[model samples]
Target: MRTIGADSPQGIPSSLNTVDIFMSHEGLLLEYEQSLTRHLPSPTDPKGERKWYNTGAHFLWIGDRTRQPDGAHVEYMRGIENPIGVKVGPTTKPEDLPELLNRIDPKKEIGKITLITRYGAGNVEKYLPAHIEAVKESGHVVVWVCDPMHGNAKVAPSGVRTRHFADIITELSKTLRIHKDNGRKLNGVHFELTGDRVTECIGGSMELSDEDLSTNYQTYCDPRLNYEQSLDVAFLIAKYYANEREDMERNVFRL
Candidate 1:
């Protein structure tokens, strides 16, 4: 998977290897790993370079079923939260995740992994902790997606109305506080964005109305925000943390 950050590109001495792997620790489908030999942190040691040199000869995000000089999984990229026939929906067992994580450990079996999950499940508020505890887990780092902009706009359950992003943001803040109060480092946020300017949190144009918010942005993963919208959320996250009186703030707002 490609990481969105500073050291990624524009010359930071990062390995930045984009190659495919047969296994991934979490939702990272091995077949989707077309290239993992690009954009990696500068290897701390020579062995790190060996890890780079030892990458798959031809990493393919899509296996034999697809072919292309350059290809992308558009469907997977669009959003695959709760599939129709699949039993793995937002409410799927959290234990299922850890098991999958083990099955997909293609990297260094590194603990303290960071993940992006649906804010709709609000697992950060509940299930995530249970999952973390069940593994007797001390090697995971979870940053939740609490952007209302990403929430389904049309079908936001019974009472969560349009323009509910602020509320969701507050909820996320509380979740962070809860984690920290309990001595867990709930380090950051996982929000969506792009390069264009987004006018509204939900809508047809760059802007959105309450009606628009009611449908599209209401889903678990809302319309992909333009670059402008994306950065707005990033700034909003920063503001959220700035207001807190906490002692430790290690939040990194990854796009």
Candidate 2:
């Protein structure tokens, strides 16, 4: 639980050394920003060109609440060169996705748009398949990412906002399977996690209970995976992808 100064050379938490190692081994890093358009440099350029909002993050995502097609957030993000993502919740209509795609990635550019789905575990089986199909039918090429944390959040009996590690894993597994069935790839996962050993979320390798939350439940908004829990999740995700790779190899050999 050692705190690293914000001004530290790498700017990542000291406890996140494992994450650094994982990313180094994986050969790529993907970072997400919420409500990215709001923080963009104001349109003060004389030619009306936006001053690039360079937060050094790899990707930016509009929040679920602000993903309206005609909204300023979408309008502003449409012109940016960086890859953009839109949070799609269970309530999001599959029909509306085409217009969003037209607005954001009109050319059907591959990897330019990412639709991050946050459909809760209860609703994902019902909602996600259609959305993926609709996007595919439209002939759009966008990445699919899962935000399992937000969708599976719950309030524990202790009154703390928390997510079950089981729920997170379940939703992510479902997401991966559904995307594969639909002939699409679930490229990434979005999580709110910290490198600190705080007892926020329940039931990781540590088997944390509701009572454990009060010991160091230090989150301002939603609960996040603690250092160990984050590492556990990383390992689980790695295993999933590794198994997928092995399956692909076997299929290729059989072919």
Candidate 1 lDDT over 37-61, as tens digits, reads 3333335565543232213332112
Q: After superposition, how far is residue 191 of candidate 1 from its true place, in Å?
A: 2.0
**Best-performing candidate as measured by lDDT:** 2
TM-score of each model, paired residue for residue:
0.47, 0.77
Write the residue-wise lDDT of candidate 2 on 1-255 in tens digits.
335433435565454454532120110222332233234544555665554452544566778888889987787677666678888998789999999999988988888888889988777889999999889888998888899988888999978799999999888988899998888888888898999999999999999999999999999998999999999999999998899899999999998
lDDT score of residue 156 within candidate 2 = 91
For model 2 the local lDDT of residue 13 reads 47
Off by over 4 Å in 1: 1-89, 106-112, 121-124, 135-164, 167-171, 203-208, 211-222, 226-232, 245-255
TM-score of 1: 0.47
The residue pairs found clashing in candidate 2 are: none
Candidate 2 overall lDDT versus native:
0.81
